[model samples]
Target chain A: MTGPPDDETRDRIDDELPDGEPPEDAPDGATGDPVPVADGGFADESAEPHEPRIAFYGGKWASTVPIVFFIFWAIVQSGVLGIGDTNGLVIGALVGTILGMFLVRGDWKAYADTIFEGMTQRVAATAIVAWLWAGMFAETLQVGGFVGGLIFAADALNVGATTFPAAAFVLCGLLATGIGTGYGATVAFVTLFFPAGVLLGANPVLLFAAILSGAVFGDNLAPVSDTTIVSAVTQDADIGGVVASRFKYAILAAVPAFAAYLIMGSVLSGASLEGAAALRESATAPGLVHLISMGVVIATAVAGRHIVEAVSWGLIVAVAFNLAFGLSSVADILVFTTTSPTPAAALPFVRVGETAGVGGSLYSGAIGFFPLIVLTLLIVAMAQIMIRGGGFEAILEFLLDSVATTVRRAELTMVLGTAAINGMITINTAAEIAIAPYIARLGEKFNINGYRRANILDANTSALGYIFPWAGGVLVGYQVMVGPDGLGEQYGPEMVVNPIEVVPYVFHGWFLVIVFLLAAITGFGREYIPDRISEEVSRA
Target chain B: MSRFEKFLAGWSLRSSTPDYEPGDVIEVMVTGAEGDRAIARIGDSTLRIEGAPGDAADTRIRVAVETWDETAHRGTGTYRETVGESAF
Candidate 1:
C-alpha cells in the first residue's frame, strides 16, 4: 500500500481514518453549492475550520490533559524510574483518559464516545495492523534461522567486530525497507543481530543506535511503511512517487550516518566479549535459506503488492522452508496445548498439558506486541480528544497567524511543528496523522508541492520516533533486550543498552531532522504545485 | 515519467514565484474556490481559473493558461475539465 496507495492503500487507509467519512458534496443552505472541508484533511477533522465538538471544563487548553498526563507519566516511569514495562505505560494512559473524562463540561457520554472513536481511528488501525502482520512474519523468519543465516554471511565475508555495527546498519536498513515497518525491524534485529553483534565485540549502545538508524532509513523510504503511506495520502501524492522523491534526502543523511557508525565501531568496543570467530560456531550455512524469504517480501512489495499480502507470502515461505530444511518443526512455528481430555492431543501441534496454552513463533511473535498496541490506541484516542476539544486548532491558528508570515518562516514552522508533535507522541504514525492537516495547510499557503510536504512530514515523524528515549521504536528494542528470553537472559544483563544511552548515537535520526531544517532554510528541493504534476491521485 | 526519473525529479532550489507563459496547459489540484472560479496557489503565485465546476475544490483539473502578470505573480486560466479525485 505504501508502494503506490493504489486501491488497496486507499481502501485500507480511508475506511479506518480517524475523521470517519470523506467530505462529500454537502450543500450550503443558502447557495446550494457544495461546501468543501479544508483540502486534504485526513485525521483529526478538528484541523479543518469546524465548530468545537466539546467544551472542556477549564477551556480548550484542558483538552491536552490526557496526553500531557501520559507524557509525564511515561517520562517519570520510563525515564526517571527506568521502568520500560509497556503495560505500566498503558495503565498510565488509562488513568489519564479517566482524568480527561472528569474535565469534560457536558455529558461525559460524549467524552467516552470520543474515546471509542479515537481508539478506532484509521491511522492507529493502519499501524496496529501492520505490526501484527510484521510481528508474525519476523518471528517465523527468526524461528527459521534467519539470524543464524546473517551470522553465516558475516562469517563468510569475514566481517569482524570493527565493521559489525556498520554492517548491521546496512542489513537492518535493507530488512526494514523490505518489511516496511521499522518496529518489526527493531524487534528482529534486537532479537537476533544484537546479541550476535555483541559477541563480535561491537559496542552495545552504538549497535543498538545503528539498528534504530537503519529503521529510520527504511521507514522514510519504503513505500510500504505506514508513515510513508499517511504522508502521501495526506499530501496528495502517489506512494511510488513519494518514495522516489524522498530517496535523495534519505541517502544524503544515510551516507554520513553510515560513516559515523563505521568510524565509531572501531573506536568503541564492547567490554567482556569473546573472540569474533566464535559466533560462527552458532551459525550454520543451511540457515541461509531464509534470505529467500526476506527477499520474497521485498520483491513482492516492490512489485506493487500490498504489505499484508507480501508479508503473508514471506511467512508462508519461511514456514515451508523451515519444514523442508529441518530448521524448525510444526511445533516450533505454532502449537496448541490444553489440559482437557481430547482426541486431538496426539496431533503434532496439540499437546495435553497442565494448562491451556498457545505457543511457538507465530503465537509468541503476535502476542508480544499486545501491550504496545493498546498503548498506541490509547495515545491516538487522546490525540483525537485534543482535536475535538479545539486544541489542535488553537496551536495551528497561533502558528499560521504569527510565525508563518513568510515562505521561509512557513517552511521552518512546518519542520519545527512536525518535530514538536512527534517529540511528544512516541508512535511515529499516530504523530504523523495528528500533524498532517497542519502541514497541508501551511505548505499549501506557500504553494509548496505535495511531494516536498510529504517528504518533510514523514522524515521528521519517522526520525524523531526512534531517537527519543521514550520513543516506541526504542522501547520495542529495549524490551527485546531485557525480555525473559532476550539478551539479558542469554548473555547477562551487561549486554543490554539502556534506551536513553542510545539516543545520542542514533545519528541518522538527528541528521534527518537537521537535513529537513536545512532544506527549509535553504529552499533546497523546494517545489511548487506547478513545478510538476504528481502521477495521479488514484494510482493502480 | 520513468521510475528513475521520479527519483531525480526535485534536485534544485526552484524559484518561489515561477514564471509560466501563456498557452501552457498544466495540471494542478484545485486548492480552493473564490467567486465563480477555482484558485490554484503555486508558491507565491496565484492563478484564477474560470469554468471550474462548483465542486472543483480539492480536485485535479487541467487548465490552459491565458494571461500572466509576472510582476504580481498572478494569472488567469480557463479550466479544461476535471481530471481526477483525491485518493482518500
Candidate 2:
C-alpha cells in the first residue's frame, strides 16, 4: 500500500475545501458547496440539499459559545457533582448543541444538519473503532487471569508490606504500558492488588495512588494507548516516532516517582503480620502465563505492525493460554446461558437447556467499551460543530498573536492548553481529540517537530486525566474500589477508598505534567525535526 | 560524528542544515518522487515539496521554503511561480 499523502497534497486539499462553511451568498440554512475530493478533483455529488455543511456564522466570540457551555457544564456535572456517569456527559453534549443553535445566523435546519455531519465524521469513527478493539483486548486479558499472574509474581517475591506499594506501582505501570489502557489497569489493580495490599497493612490511599501513577505512565508511553494514538494521529506524527521521542521524558519522571513510592511504601506499612502467610498461599502459578500475552502486544507494536493487528494477536494468545493451561474453561472464557424469564431464550443460537448470561472474558471485554465509544463519538461531534463555527480559529489566533510570540512561549502554550482542556473534561481521549488541532496548527507555525508536539499533547492529556478527583480514570478506579466484590465486602465498608483521597497521592500523574511544563520552559528533552513535515495528515 | 554524538543523536535537537531559513528561494535537484510530492536534495539534506505537478521529478526546480524545522532536517516548500531565465 502507498504511504500517507504528502504535505503539499494535504495543504492543497485543505486550502480548496471549506469543511462545513456556507458560501457568502448562500441563502439562510442552505447547504453550501459540495465536498471537494482530494487531488483538487471531483465533487461529492451524493451530498443532499439538506445535508449540513460547516460554515462561519458569526464572529469568533459567538462561535465559541457552544464549546464554552460544554466545558462549563462538564466541570459542574463531573467535577463539582463528582458524578462520572457517561449518560450525564452525553446529556451535557446534547444540551450544548441545542444552546449553540441560537449563535448561528442560518435556519434551524442548517444548524441541525451540522450536528449530524459532526457526529459521523471520520475522525470520531476512527477513534471509536480503536477503542472497541482495545476494550476487547483489555477485557480478554483480565478474564484470562492476567491480574492473578501479577499477584502470583508479587507473592513469589515475598516483598515486605512497606515495599509492596512501590513494587505494585512498577508492575502495574508495566502492565498498563503493554496493554495500553489505564482504565483496564485501574480495574485489575484495584480489584486484585488493592485488597492484597490492604491485607498486608499498606496505606489504602497511597497504594491506590501508586496504581494511578502506573496508569499515567502507561497511558503516556504505551503505543496501543488511546491518548497516544489520538496524539500521534492528530499531530500527523508516526506512532513509532512519537513513542520513541517520549521515552526520555517518561523515564525522567518515572525515576523520581518510583523512588517516592519506595519511600512511602516503607514508611506507610501499618498492617499486622498475622494474615500475610495465608495471602501468600492463595497466589497461583497458572496466572503467570499472561505475562507472555502482554509481551506479544509490546513486541508487535514496537516492530511497527498495525496496532489493531498487534492487539488482536495478543487477545488470541491470551485466550489460548487461558484454556490450554486449564486456568479458565472455554465456557468461562465465553458462555451464553438462557433462563425462563430471560428474553435470550427466543434467539436461535440459544440452546434450550444452555445457560444464557453474557459470561467469559471475550464477550464482556469487547462489550465493556460500548458506553465510552458512544460518548467519544458524541463529544467529537460537538467538537466538530465548534471547529466549523470558527471557535477553534478564534482561540488559535488569540494564542498565536498574543501568548506565543516566541518558540518557547509557543511550546508552553501547547503544554498548558492541552492540560487545561483535559482538566475540565473528564474523558482524556475526548479532550485530546478536541485540543489536538490547536497543537498541530500552532506547532507548525513555529516549525515544531511532529514528535515534540505529539509528546507534549499526550503527556498533559494523560497526566491531567488521572490526577483530578473527577477524572474518569480516578473515578473508575474508585468505583471498583467500592463495588460489592471490591474492598468493601472483602475488608469491610470502612476500607473503601474515596476518589478524593487518592488525588493528592497520584504522584506520577502530577510529576508528568510538571516535567512537561519544565520541558516547555527549559527545553529539556525538546527536539525539533528540521525540514520534514509530519507524514500523517491532521484529521482535525 | 563521535560515538558520544551518535548516542545522543536521537535525544538532541541539533540541526543537520542550520543555515536554511523560511522564505529563502533556492534551486534544488529533485532526487526522488512519491505520489504528488517531490523530494529535493540540497547538499547533504533533503526537502519535501507537496503538490508539485508530475514530471517535476528528476529535474531542477526553483521553490520557496515555507517552513524549516532544523532539528528534523526537513522543510515544506512551495513551487515558485516565476524564476529568472538564468535561475537554474
Give TM-score values for chain A, per-prediction: 0.85, 0.71
> For candidate 2, lDDT tens digit of each residue in A1-540?
001222452233223445543344232224445432221111222211111233444554455566567667756775677654555666776777777787665445545655676667664565455545655565565556655565566667777567778877897898778767776666667756776676666888788899989989999988878788888887667776677678888888899998998888777655444555575567576777877876787687656666577778887898888778877776656766665555754553343344446655566555555555565556666665655554554454556557765567778888888887677556678677767766765564444566788899999999988887656677566655443233464457545665666777788888888888788777676554443434443321
Instruction: Please list, in the order the candidates appear, how each scores on TM-score for chain B only.
Output: 0.87, 0.64
Model 1 lDDT per residue over A147-214, tens place: 77777777689887879989889988998887788887888788778877787667999999999999
Best-performing candidate as measured by TM-score: 1
**lDDT values, one for every candidate:** 0.77, 0.64
Interface RMSD of 1: 4.9
In model 1, what lDDT does residue A49 have? 40
Give the clashing pairs for model 1.
A2-A223, A3-A223, A16-A122, A17-A122, A447-B43
Residue A306 of model 1, lDDT score = 83
Best by DockQ: 1
